[model samples]
Target: MPRAIGPVLVEGPVEVVLPDGTVVVSERPVVALCLCRRSRRYPFCDTSHRRRSRPSVERPADGEQA
Candidate 1:
């Protein structure tokens, strides 16, 4: 039998029946809907939660003061 796990979290290849009597299918092993509203793919996880790199620090010259 098929069922929904949570509001946004669902198992793979879940079949969603729209209000218009249309059916939508997901073919992934696991479907993670975007809650933060930052995912480019929307309603799917594209690994966009990774942190960004920091700016590089500048070092002093050989004869620079302590």
Candidate 2:
């Protein structure tokens, strides 16, 4: 199922078959699969989705003024 702030959840131990036929196995009681594709650990959630992108802060050039 989808979560409001995280990856989709599924019961384990699960054997996930990738598009390329690569199989991934997890022995945990529960698994969190990444849907946003932002996780460094593909097919598994590493809590990367919880991290918000930081906006660039524009500072005054050469500190002329704030």
Candidate 3:
């Protein structure tokens, strides 16, 4: 089985080349892909998190119930 790759710190999206010369694209470090590209989520901060705000509710989308 292939190992899970990374918490790879990068300034932008990176091309991950495998040992076999196959390349995989890691998720864009940006938060909102089309937005201003500044977000609370680091590496790429789209600033969308700044817009999607209700300070009274901190639970993320997964329903883990923060």
Model 3 residue runs over 4 Å out of place are 1-6, 30-66
> What are the lDDT figures for the candidates, one per model?
0.63, 0.90, 0.45
TM-score, predicted candidate 2 vs. hidden true structure: 0.71
Tens digits of per-residue lDDT, candidate 1, 18-51, equal 5588776789877776555456765564556553
Superior candidate under TM-score, 1 versus 3:
1
> Considering summed lDDT, which 10 consecutive residues are worst modelled in model 2?
1-10
Candidates 1 and 3 compared: the better one by lDDT is 1
Cα deviation of 32, candidate 2, in Å:
0.4
Candidate 3 lDDT tens digits, 1-66: 664222324544665555588775646663223224344433333445346445685557785655
Model 1: per-residue Cα lDDT at residue 19 = 59
Which candidate has the highest lDDT of all? 2
- Cα lDDT tens digits for candidate 2, 1-66: 755567889999999999999999999999999987889998999999989978989899995887
Please list the Cα RMSD from the true structure of every candidate, rounded to 1 decimal place: 8.4, 3.8, 13.3
Order the candidates by TM-score, highest first — what do you get?
2, 1, 3
Better of 1 and 2 by TM-score: 2
For model 2, the local distance difference test gives 0.90
Clashing pairs in 1: none
Each model's number of backbone clashes? 0, 0, 6
